[model samples]
Target: MIDGALFVVVLVGALVCAVSAGALYAFSSFVMKGLTALPPAQGIAAMQAINRAAPGPAFMVAFLGGALLSAVIAVFTLVSWPGEGGPLLLVGCALYLFGMLGISAVAHFPRNDALDKVDPEAPASAAYWRDWAREWTRWNHIRTAAALAAATLFVLALVR
Candidate 1:
């Protein structure tokens, strides 16, 4: 019974996280597009402003929410320890969690903390800000990709 419950939770959470991960990946692309459409200096300035603003909190809410849901699944998996693929799904969930944490601890949180020191409305160095934004976005892309991959593996586990 518990195994059944865990399987259900993992399946559902994986689906939700996968969708959200894809959405975030697309959003990054959208931001890039928006930047490209702008004049070079203006684009750099806008990206800088956005970076200083630490807009990731909103996304983190989603990421963390998904993670919490997955935690339930993880607990279930551990308790139940279903068939062969069950372990794989759990591994996927773990990877996803690590990726999310990596983004938060390594990339996003630091950027946000730094942003707290800087003025989003009036940046000190547009060049420095641009560099930071690019780096942050790059990490975000990696995070999102890993999350999606994890979600995919989890879904595959369901099929197996």
Candidate 2:
């Protein structure tokens, strides 16, 4: 019963959310494990390099665009109050916005900032890297789940 335009928006949002989830999943499932297995200095330096590279347009479009589209979809859904699909859309938007992006902002970025300040070769950096990588990967798992859940909800909304 959803309108065509809204359907398209939700579809695109789901795809973007899935992309973000996949990226996070990669980190959680293997990337972090691989990085952490490297010598601590190497791990720290590699993570720093990754953090530097992550903010570019390719990744930003998928991550940021998902949030942006979620907002748009949420607002539209609320204003229109379209049948059963409406609540699903709202919850999906909430998950993508708060669960995914919010966690990244509140949890990941601060850690990355702290990592940036560490001297990778220092003994202290090794200690910090151990904790940082563990904590960062844990939060990434949460983000991955959130994004994947949001994408699932988006699909459910479409089918409803």
Candidate 3:
């Protein structure tokens, strides 16, 4: 029964990681470009609005939920290591919990918070917007890579 439950959690974690990768991918692939192309004030407005709107339940479920599920998967795999999919699960956990969640906490959210403080219409805010766009996008690209890697690792764990 424990093994069965662990299997279910692993599956859910994989799905969540995949979903997160998609979200990060969208931001890096086109959203940033779209925002960067707009007039400085308009871009800042849109970015601030986007940052404001991005923190709802759906995202929280996938982001925080994935990290939580990965932690569980790691624990379960440790107990059943070698005989089960131990290595794969542990790797997945590190990638999702450390790579994805850790990077977001350390790198991305702080930038968002800083952006929130600057008034988009102010003269300095335009410069802030430019710097913010480049730096945020760079970190987001890192996030996208980490999330996609986590998703791959989780899916592989299931197959193993």
**lDDT winner:** 2
Candidate 2: stretches off by over 4 Å: none
Tens digit of per-residue lDDT, candidate 3, span 13-108:
888988998998999999999999998899988888888988899898898988999888887778776646677678878988878898899988
lDDT by candidate, in order shown: 0.69, 0.93, 0.83
Candidate closest to the true structure, highest TM-score: 2
The lDDT, on a scale of 0 to 1, for candidate 2 is: 0.93
What residue runs in model 3 are displaced by over 4 Å at the alpha carbon? 1-3
Worst 10 residues of 2 by lDDT: 79-88
The window of 10 residues in a row where model 1 has the poorest summed lDDT is: 116-125
Query: Who is ahead in TM-score, 1 or 3?
Result: 3
Off by over 4 Å in 1: 1-3, 36-61, 120-123
* lDDT, candidate 1, 37-119, per-residue tens: 66555665565566565447765556776788778767766766756576777777777778865676888778756744555
Please give the lDDT score at residue 88 for candidate 1.
73
TM-score between candidate 2 and the true structure: 0.98
C-alpha TM-scores of all predictions: 0.75, 0.98, 0.93
Shift of residue 40 alpha carbon in model 1, Å = 8.5
Winner on lDDT (2 vs 3) = 2
